[model samples]
Target: MAANIVFTRIDNRLVHGQVGVTWTKAVNANLLLVANDEAASDPLMQKLMSTTAESSGAGIRFFTLQHTIDIISKAADRQHIFIVVKTPQDCEKLIAGGVPIKTVNVGNMHFAQGKTEITKKVYVDADDKKALLDIAHKGVDIYIQDYPGEKKTTVDDALLSKVQ
Candidate 1:
């Protein structure tokens, strides 16, 4: 990917087969920012995701949470970077480290054993929801939009906006 694709989204699944097959085309994205420390450390994980994406041409870069903070803070190029994270805590960490993202589009996060329902498509456990709310309060526009055209339920401002 080109490091310039412009979808600032997060999904625990990160860039999976669905992302490559669907969202890439839909959003016209060319750069993917995989923001996860573990993923950055694991070369195999990077290779696997790249393969899944077919590495057809899109630029995919995996970065530790801290590095991601620096990258976003300094760059505003044209490639359309899709910033991704596995959970709200990860997102929180990035921001606390000094990354200032303005919006976050949630792609997917499945319900684990004990998660609360914030919306039809959003589910957050107590601590995670708190973190998410904190991020929202900081002016990040958190939205749940699994696929293209899916109704985007806001993570802030919407009265019913609590990641369930």
Candidate 2:
């Protein structure tokens, strides 16, 4: 059975204090899944994030893109999973891999040299824009909100046009 995905968010800083405590509590999620290729391959990152999640009273797991697709696909229905990815590209992959993601919350994408600010917490470059637009085209709802209580800025044509 597909995993009970209660929340899916794209935050560069995955499984941090805000996510592990605030969002997990907000969503009432039991599991926190960090679906990032770099984090999955690094033992130090996994350990650190695992410790954080445990401290927050939520079970945590780090998986690569393909591994996330494989594992989440077979997860039990009772496991309320909160998925966090670093980029929109990764979010797109999860949907393509049949993870059953319907809505994506854009939490934080830190400023980079080539990126432009979309919201106070969201900055996107060309590639990021393309991936996000593709995801939107596939009928997925995308919005930017830093925290659970904040207002969400929907990713629409007007939003995409502002990237350039």
Candidate 3:
């Protein structure tokens, strides 16, 4: 049985109001999978995510990066899943592990000292760009779009705009 993955997104915030509500509803995803090592090991974070999901009427689960690949690889046929990772590197890991990702949404990445602002809501450094480019090379379309209905800006366009 193969999982029906609606979308794979990278959001530093993980399962917050926008993702727990907006993106999940946009993809009509029953399962909100978070693949992050830090969050997976944190009980408080898990509890908070669970609470948020419950309030939003969405199912949520947290998995370590490798476990996420293992579990998602064997997901049931009827599972309508939406994957969220904290970094593009995580998305690359899943994709490389054969997650069958088609489009990757760049939701939010806050500005850091070493990171360049790619968009109002997204920031990245060299490693981040490399990971995103790697995902792109695997034939996955990478776009920066905070929410579902908002205009999507392709990674190429974002980079181009940065140079212009």
Candidate 4:
């Protein structure tokens, strides 16, 4: 029994104010899952995420990518889920591992050493663009927007090529 995934977002900064409050309410999700390997293993980050969730009034969990793949189905049956992954590549891996990711929201991925800016908030390198293209090929809609009310920039082939 997989949990019903109401929303999926790719945000480097997981469990932030907007995600803790706005997106959780928008999706009507009770469970906020931070599915990132680094964050799940770090106690400091775990505490911070928990503290953020306390204010949002949403149940939150953290799991590494493999752990998420193992437990997501059963968890979904119990709670309406909202998942946030740290990168597009992670999201792609999750989808390949059997999570039914119908749509992916690219929120905030900070500028890295080898990455170029595609949008004001999104920066990607060749690998990132490739991962996003792969996800899109699997029939998942990948779009960018940090806030709920803002316009979503779809990551179509044209946009991906431009970035690459």
**How well is each residue in 1-164 modelled by candidate 4, as lDDT tens digits?**
55699999999898888999999998888889999999988999999888887787889999999999988877647688899998989999999999978999999989989898889999999989999999999999889988888999999788877775
lDDT of 3 at 152: 87
Q: In model 2, which regions exceed 4 Å deviation?
A: none
Task: Looking at model 1, report the run of 10 residues with the lowest lDDT sum.
Answer: 1-10
lDDT by residue (tens digit), candidate 1, 2-37: 234356666778878767657776777777778899
Where model 4 places Cα greater than 4 Å from the true spot, the runs are 76-78
**Model 3 backbone overlap count:** 0
Report clashes for each candidate as comma-separated counts: 18, 0, 0, 4
Report the C-alpha lDDT of model 3 over 1-164, residue by residue, as the tens digit.
56788988999989988888878887888888888999999999999888877766778889999998787768876778888899999999988887778999998989988888888999888888888888877778889998778998888634734431
Clashing pairs in model 4? 1-73, 2-73, 3-76, 3-77
Error of 4 at 48 (Å): 0.6
Taking all chains together, each candidate's TM-score versus the true structure is 0.82, 0.95, 0.93, 0.95
lDDT of each: 0.73, 0.89, 0.85, 0.89
**TM-score of candidate 4 relative to the true fold:** 0.95
